[model samples]
Every structure is written in C-alpha cells, then in structure tokens.
Target: MILGWRKRRIARHAGKKNPPGNQEMELVIPNHFRCPISLELMKDPVTLSSGITYDRESIETWLEAGNFTCPVTNSMLRSFDQIPNHTLRKMIQDWCVEKQNYGVERIPTPRTPVTPIEVSEILFDVSASSLDVDQYRCLELVQKIQKWGAESERNRRCIVANGAAAVLAAAFDAFSNDSVERNVAVLEEILSALNWMFPFDVEAQKSLGSRASLGCMIWFLSSKDLSPKQDSIVALKELLACDQKLVEKLSDFEGVNEMLVEFVKKQICPTITKASIMVIFYMVSVAYSSSEKIKLAFVKMGLVSLLLEILVDSEKSICERALGVLCGLCSCKEGREEAQSNALTVPVMVKKILRVSDLATEYSISTISELCKYGRRDEGKILVEALQVGAFQKLLLVIQVGCGDKTKEKATELLKLLNPYRAGLECIESVDFKNLKRSF
Candidate 1:
C-alpha cells in the first residue's frame, strides 16, 4: 500500500519539477498506475487479447509503444480484434481529475523520432508484431512523425525511407516463396511509405530505382508461380485500378513519365526472363499508361514499326512478344489498326517477314513463308511483288540449311506458289542456286 502511494506521490511531484513547456517536461509521465481503457488498478496491466485498448488520455504516454500484450495476461493479441477496456479507462480519468485538483500539471511530450533505428526498434515491438495499431496510437505516430518532419534530428527522414524499404523487403521475402493475402497489406504499406518518403526526400524516388522497386513488388504480387489466392487477386486488381495520387506525383516528378516511356518503348523484349513478365505487363498495361507523351514516345522510338518488324525476328520468343503486343493493340478501343495502317504497319510487317524468311533458321523460314503466303492475300499484291524479287531464293537458302522435312515440305509448297525463277531471270542475270540448293 505504501509503495503504491509513494509511486503516485512520486508521479505527482515529478510533474511539478518539469513545469509546463519546460524542456524537462518532455520526460514526465502521468501520475497513475492504471490502464487507459479499464478505469481500475490494471490487474494484469496487459494489453487486451484483440491487440488494442482505449485508455484515459492521461495514461497514454505511459504505455510502451507497439506493444499489444495485456500487461497482465502476456498472451499474444491479434491486432484487428482489439477492444477497449472501459473500466481501466475510467480509472485513469479519475486519476487525472485528482491530479488536476492537486495542482499537478501534465507535460505533453512530442512524438519520438521515426528514424531507421526507431523503426527497427518499433518493428520488434508487440503491436507491429501482431499487425495492429489502435486509432489513438496511429494518430500519435503520425503526429510524432509530422512534428519531427524535415527538421527532425538524427537524419530521421532517410531513416523512415530506408526503414520502409526494409519492411517492404521483409514482406516481399516472406511472400517470395509462398503466395499469401497478407502480402497485399505489406505491399500497400510499402507503397504508402514510398510515397511518404518521396516528398520528404527526392532521392527516395529514384527514377530507375523506384521503378525497379515497384516493378519487383508488382511482379511478386501477380506472380503466376504463387497460388494467387482470391484475396491476392483482389488486392492486385485494386492496386491496378488507378492511382490518382501517383498520377499527380508523376506529373510533378519531372522525368518519371519520360523514363517510363523509354522503358516501354525501347526496353521490353520477349527474350526477357519469365519472372519479369508480370512487370512488363504492368508497365505496358498500367504504369507507362495511355498518355499522349507515352503514345508519342512509342512513335518517336519507332516502336510501332519496330514491333511489327520484330514479329518476324528469327527468335521465336521475340516474335511472340511482338505479336502479342500487336494483338493486344488490335483489341483496344484505340484505333491501333488504323494507326498501323496509316503508319505503314502492314507494309513494314510484310517487308520484315519477307526479309526474315530469306535469312532466318528453317523454323523461322517456314513460319515466315507461311505467314507471307497467307499475308499477301490480305495485305495485298505490293507485298507479294516485294517477295518475288529473288527474296524467295534467299529464303530457300535458309530453308535448305535448317528446314526439317515438314519445313521443307512447307517451303516447297510456298516456292511452287511464289516461283521467283521468272522474276529472278528478269532482275538478276546470275541465280544463286548453289546457295539456294544448299538451303534446300
């Protein structure tokens, strides 16, 4: 009994020495041995089973931050389910009243720094461990962070930025091997922190670096390797829906849009590893976007023509990717086909395929020959005329080198139909039949 009285007395008198607004006031604690939620003597002084509790505002500073365990039970609490213990709440309120009557003034403390070290320390705490934060505590951390803003000591802003990256990396690592809905929460937090860090420091959003970070996160979230539980799907969809804030940020970030345009227009190729597909998809379909700059960037980079030309590349994967993008464009609301036509899309594709057929592997020769055979029908005679001028001879040369029986059979059939002999005789005096026979 005496010990409790002495503790209260100490708390009360300690408040006096600090005085209001004194620098020393920052360290003072309220004079109470009570829980904020339950008004009574905190029996176990434990955090509730649900991971949150309401306490009298007076005893708020007394609780250890990010700790959710009931001081009494010591049982692990899940964050989302925490409910306030009102009885303990009332007791603390009563104590505050008594302290007020006794002329004890409360000294309010500013929030602690949110530096890397602080974030690291907090992560090991129980509350974050349980993945829960009550409203008041969240507000407190925000206030604290805001108070410490820009001018914060100990290089706090950078700490928060790096700390956020660490947390995001941890979340990604956790889900790297297994797909889980929990990944969404962690991803969202990472994105939020990235946003926070950007305004706080420009380096936080490195043009290439942030793109890579987000690219990785998006890849993991949409990874086909993972189970892709329903929740994960929903979460990914939500993220893709639209980010007004990100759009605004991009508008102000100077080079972000241009960087994105460059990546989309010139960087992606089908030869890229499988793990990178989702990122490519997201960048094309979501991130790089449909803005005029992006559209013009593609045009400026000659992507439209290059993409069509690449469709006939000897590399199957590269051809497939280019084809896929073309197919996707055909299905869009944009007059992609119209643009292609106006921009010499058909002529370019036909010309490239014809040329590829002349020098490509037999497999490529067969595919391009078949495409050319059927393509000129829909694409027109101009394309076929382009192919007849000894181009078929070059194609036969390639076919002879690598063509399997089936490929040779197809090439023969195409040759019968294309008959470059007459055109070859008329155009070039000497026929390169030696090389052509070698291909055959």
Candidate 2:
C-alpha cells in the first residue's frame, strides 16, 4: 500500500516522469513562455531592445517597466530608446524554443508590494530636550508609541518610526562602560517592538529594527567592563529568533542580511539557518580570544566553505568586512594552526587584500599587525611586509590630512608594531607618552 501511494504521488507530479533518481522535474511556468536564450527556464524573464521575435509577454512587461535585460544572457534589452530591427530579429529566432518533453506551463502573476503600516503620532511628539532620558524610561516612552503604531489608522501609526529612532539615540546615551544589564534591557524592549511592528508595516518595522539593532551592537561590543551574562544570552536568543523570521520574510533587503551577519558574528546563537552567519562571526571574534571552544564550534558548523566564498566575492566592502572577521578568527590561540591546516587564511589575503579601498586597506593592515602580535612568526612577517616603509608613508599622509585623531592613534600603533624601537623612541619624544608612562 505504501509503495502504491508513493508511486501515485510521483505520478501526480505534472509532467515530471522519469525513472527513480533520473526523474525529470516539471518546469511550472505561470504562462506558456520560455526564454529563447537559456531554453531551460524562464526565471526573471525579460526582453531585449531589438525589435525581435524572441520576446514573451512577460519579457515585454518587464521591458515596459524599465528592466530591459534578458535573464539568461544579461544582455541589454529594451530602453526608452528604440531597439534596432536587426537586433530584434536575431534575439527572437535565438530565444524562442519549445521543449516537447516538458509538461508544465506557468502563468505570470503581478507582484504586490507589501503595504507599510501607520505609526503612532505620539512618537513624533518627542522633543530634542527628551533625548537625554534614562534608558528604561526612554524605552517605556517608545513602548507607548509602538502600541499606538499598531492602530488601524494610517496617520496615527506613522509616528512610531520617529519615536523608535529617538529611543535608539537615548539607548546609546544610556549605555555606559559598565552596563550589560541595561544594554540587554534596551535590546529586549526594541526586539519586542520589532516583533510587533514587522508583520504590518515592513518599512517602519525595518527602520525601527535597523536603528535599534545597530545601537544595541555598539553598546554591547564597545563596553569595556561589561560582558554577556545569562539574561543577556536569553535576550540575544530572542533577538536571533526574531531576526530569523524577518530574514525569511524579507531576504531581498541587503540591510537585513548585513545586520544578520553582524549579529551572528557578535553573538553566538546555536540556530541552524543562521549557521553561515554564526561561523563567519565566530571566526572574526577569534582575534580577541582564541577560545578553543569557539574554534571547535566553527569546525562543527562547517565554516570553511563560507569563508572561502567571502574571500572570493567581488564586493570590496564585503571582502574587507569578511577578511577583518576572518583575520581576527585566524589569530585565536589554536586558530593559527587550524587556519593553516584548513588553508583558510593565505588564499583570502592573496585575492582580496590588494583590492580593498584605502580605509579598508588601513584596517586590514592594522588587523594583521594585531594578529602578528599573537600568530606565528612567519605569518607576522607577512603582515609586517605589507606595512612596509612606503605603505607607512601613505598611512601617515592619510592620518595628517584625511583622518581624525582616532585614526592617527591607530596609525601610530601600526608604525610601532612595524618598528618597535623607533616607535618607542618617538613615544619618548612626545610629552603625552611621557605623561602616559608616568601614570602607569
């Protein structure tokens, strides 16, 4: 009976008929349309500028809507400008093909944009004078705004977004060098608001969540005297769960993806879908402490492939961020050997290092210096070479004219790392260093 049921299920799959493992999957088209360029599928179907026969209704629609490119070839298609007749004919002949064996035809459907929610008007009532309120008090004020944001009235709810941002700024103000509990409390409150806000109005929901999440991160990571405790862990778990749901609903948003990546690196949550983010985050945090447990966890999570992917991505911003995190992870106590064994560190530097922008270049250099302070001599030497005299000269130029005092301090430290004796002599020459040494 079970075998009969299974066979029936397989048989019912429209036009999907092949023997066992070799079964051909049916291509379901919203309309009976196929791209002439890539004959197999009509995904994101679009048309070209050529007055050609290859265009489908879906392609024509996409072209009219101003997305004039073929999905398969990524070739430029229809524009406000006219397509030449020769180009149109060639595309039509090449892209229009029919597969007789395939049994499903798909119909194209218009995509509906998710409606935004009305935020509470009370949120906007906050004055610049109120920006200095206590964290919990600020949170409470925002809570009422969030409550009113859920109202059916559109204008009433629009206020919640501004309230959310105000509350975020206040939360940052409230965070101190020794306030883990307060930080967790702020995040918890924001997460609660986010959970309620996202389902109805995605824009307001995203706006509120983005500011809160970023603020929470700054407070949590920058705290010199606070670390995660049990309650903090629970709060992080809740936030992760909420973010996971949001990611599922809105995978198209890059901000969501970036924040998800940032959180996974900072907080080690043991969920499955965020496993990729977790591994990358873990590797990056390793520079602070080479905890074997974290290293082992990364191994178990299978991060080797993902790290390699980040190393190879063409985006300079992404590459820099990934490399910063990976370099930190690679310098952990047992991380150097593990990184070498798995071959995660070298190939990444080779492909990505030179391509990074000036600011990122400085960060990468500084990170390598920090790594060298703990990593094997050979690895350290490689980092030192990258910060050679000429590189240091360029870095100095950036510090003198382009960067602020903070960047200058980092540049000074990197110079120290490159040549400690000279750095020490220079430090002795400075009144600030003399005072700093005296204080110590």
Candidate 3:
C-alpha cells in the first residue's frame, strides 16, 4: 500500500515539485501479486474454499496452526482443500520477468504431491533388489516422500495409507544385510523413514510389534550409532504403546531393559528420554503386578535414583511416567531398598502430590506406601522422613482436594500411619478420616 501511494505521488508530480513527506518513489507491488497472509508476492498461489488465494506455504502454515477461519476474509473456512491458481502463477511469472530491474526472479513450478501409488512403486524398487544401486535410488525416493509428507497433512496420510511401514522395514532389512558404506547411509534413511511412518500405520503398528521386528529394534538400540539408536527407541515406543504383550516381553529380548536404563542415565536426547520413559511404562504395566523378577530388574538398574533425578524439574508428562514406573518398581523388596538409598526419594514423592496430575498423585501415594510398607529396617525412618518432609500436610491436602476417592482413602491411610510420628502439628488437627474410608 505504501509503495502504491508512492508510485501515484511520483506519477502526479512528473516533471513537477515533489509531494510533501516524499523523498523517493518506489515500485508499487500489485495487490493480486501479494499473498494476503505474508503480504509478499505469491510464488505458487492456491485458492481455498473461501475463494481466497495464498501462497501454498503460507496457507498451509495457517491450517497447521489450527486456524479454521480464513486469514483474509475472517469468515469460516469451508474446507482445507486447495486448488492451484495456474493463471495467477503464470501472471506472477511474467510480472517477475517484467520487474527484472527490481531483482525479482521467476519462481519454479512446484512438484505434484506424492501419491499412494507412487509410494507403492518405490517399495517395489526397494524389494526388486538385483543390485545395491537400485536399493540406493529407492532410499533417495523414500527420503523425498518423507520430506513432502512432513510439509502437509494430506501427503502424510497418503504415504501411510499405501503401507510405508512395511516398505521402510524392508529397506532396513535389505540394507542391513550389506556392509557397504552406501548401504549404511541407506540403512540410516530407512530407520528414519520407518520412525516417521510407524506412528500412523494402524495395521502395521500391530504387525511390526511381532517378535522378529521387536528383535530388529532391540538390535538397533544396542548399536553405537547415536542417530539411528535414538530413532529406534522412538519407534519401539510407538510399537509397544499399542501392544501390551510386547511390552511384557521386553525381558524376552536380552539386555533391552538395561539398554533403556543406560539411555536414561546418559541423558543423550530429550526424545530419547521421553521414549525410554514410555517404554518402561508399558514394560512395568503388567509386570509390576505379577512378576517379582521384573521389579528386581528395574531396581538393579538403579532406576530409583534415575527417576528421582528426573522428577526434580521434569515436565508434567515425564514426571507422571516416572512416578508410574516407580510405583511398579517399588513393589518388591529390592526396589524399596534402592529407593531408600536415595535421600531425595521421600522428599520428591512428598512434593509431587497435587502438583502434576491426579494420576501422578496416585502413583506418588502408591510409591510412598510401598516404601513405608515394604521397608524392612527403613520403615520407621521412612515414616519419620515423611513427617520431616511434610508428607502429612500434603496427604491431608490430597484428601481435602478433588483427587479421586481411592486417592483420598489411600492418603487417609498414609496419614493415619504417620500420626504417631507427628506430635505437635496443627496441619493434622483438622484431618478427618470419617468420610474418606475405603468401602472395600
């Protein structure tokens, strides 16, 4: 708009006096050439259901930000569907040529979006491996597909619908069999592609949790490569998330539990940290209830101190998952001892209640209960530590707040158990356990 005004001012003052507040006139950028969202010349203009044109990149960004209203019209967006403005694109190209003095360059035509059939054909290129070069070309194409799909939700669904999961796994297996450096690069790309597609492959998620596929993931996690190892754990987390039985079988894969602990202790990547926590969540989902050996495995890994360290300043999700894993590991005698070894364990648990979530409060209460109930020689000290750390006050607070009934009943029990240790505290005077009793 400023440029347009300046151009008019220059035309009106042709061979005459300069207009007030005007030093130099600039080229006026045409309104049609500008994208409403970016206010810049449109490269690949596409129209939405609101009959508004925008550069494909700008409009897609708007949609991805969860906006359902048109940026230009402020009306409801009828649909996310976009049609390419071929005529407008041609005009923009010609205008760029005419405006060469202004350093404008013609934009190249965008490639057609990758289709499901194209992904299937690329999988065939991977599977028909008469030579390593064929597999390499397929790897490059898979990378291209991943790039395109990540840019827009439409292409991501298209790639997933055409069985990108199985193709990626095939690429992993085929290239993994070869030791060539080129094949190593191919294998890295395959791992990445698999990680990107694994979460969306509904049918393939279950199938990929099979024993053989689980073994392949375990092998990757055991490797020394920092990059693929991170992707492997993330993919493993996606798989075990839907398959509880596979989680229970984590011990069935030798050294899987230990690898997860080492990854957590190293604190390599944030995603790795989150993925490791999730994997352990499923691992102990059922094992904590039925298997003492599983509890022993986690304790022996020093998971207690590890969790205590993360619970200090971790995010809510990570804090909750850590509490869950702690609740499970604290089931056995070994687990209790490991937790007791860490001085901050009691204090951290006492602090987490009413801070993270209702479920976190439950897990925190359960963990403290296990420590108080199962601590052989440390039970008395645990109660004293709880009182010293103000667990009594928090327990009363939990009962007074909107936590679940079961949580209230548990908190009441824990408080009653600790009452003898607190001889002079007003926080416990108002505590009433009459209505908080468990029916069962």
Off by over 4 Å in 2: 1-292, 299-305, 340-359, 379-440
Best by TM-score: 3
The TM-score between candidate 3 and the true structure equals 0.74
What is the alpha-carbon lDDT for the whole of candidate 3?
0.75
Query: With candidate 2 superimposed using the best TM-score fit, by how many Å does residue 123's alpha carbon deviate from the native?
Result: 16
* Candidate 1 residue lDDT tens string, 1-440: 11122123234556544334442221223435534445434422323444445332322333335554544455555542334454554555455456553444332322333445666564344134324423234334433443444444334444564444344334333333233343444443333333334332222223213433344444534444433222222222233333323332333334433433344344343222221222222333433445434444434544455555445433544444444444333333232433334434433443333233333233333334434454544333423543544446554553546546765676676666656434534232133443333322
**Candidate 2 residue lDDT tens string, 1-440:** 01111123344546555577745443443232334643433433333455333333345445557775655567765453322234433333343333223432233331221122323333333333234444565566556655554543332334433344443334433343225364566554544454333232333334334534434543443334233222222333334334443322233223433434444444344332233343344334433333455454444444434555555643564555555555555555554545444543443443332346555555455444445555655654544443432344444444554454655676676666556433322211122112111111
Per-residue lDDT of candidate 3, residues 1-440 (tens digit): 53432233334435565667765456777898899989988877999998999998889788888999999889998788889999999998888777654445677777566666777886677666514546557667777776877766667767777777776665565554444344656666766877767563555665456565566667778778888789888888887776666666566888888989988888788889889988887777665344677667888778888899989999997898889988888877788888888998988998887677879989999889888777758877888888876788778767765678777777887888898878763233233332443434
Task: Point out where model 1 deviates above 4 Å.
Answer: 1-262, 266-306, 309-383, 388-390, 404-410, 420-440
Ranking by TM-score: 3, 2, 1
| Candidate 2 structure lDDT | 0.42
TM-score against truth, every candidate: 0.29, 0.32, 0.74
Please report, as a residue range, the 10-residue window in candidate 1 with the lowest summed lDDT. Answer: 1-10
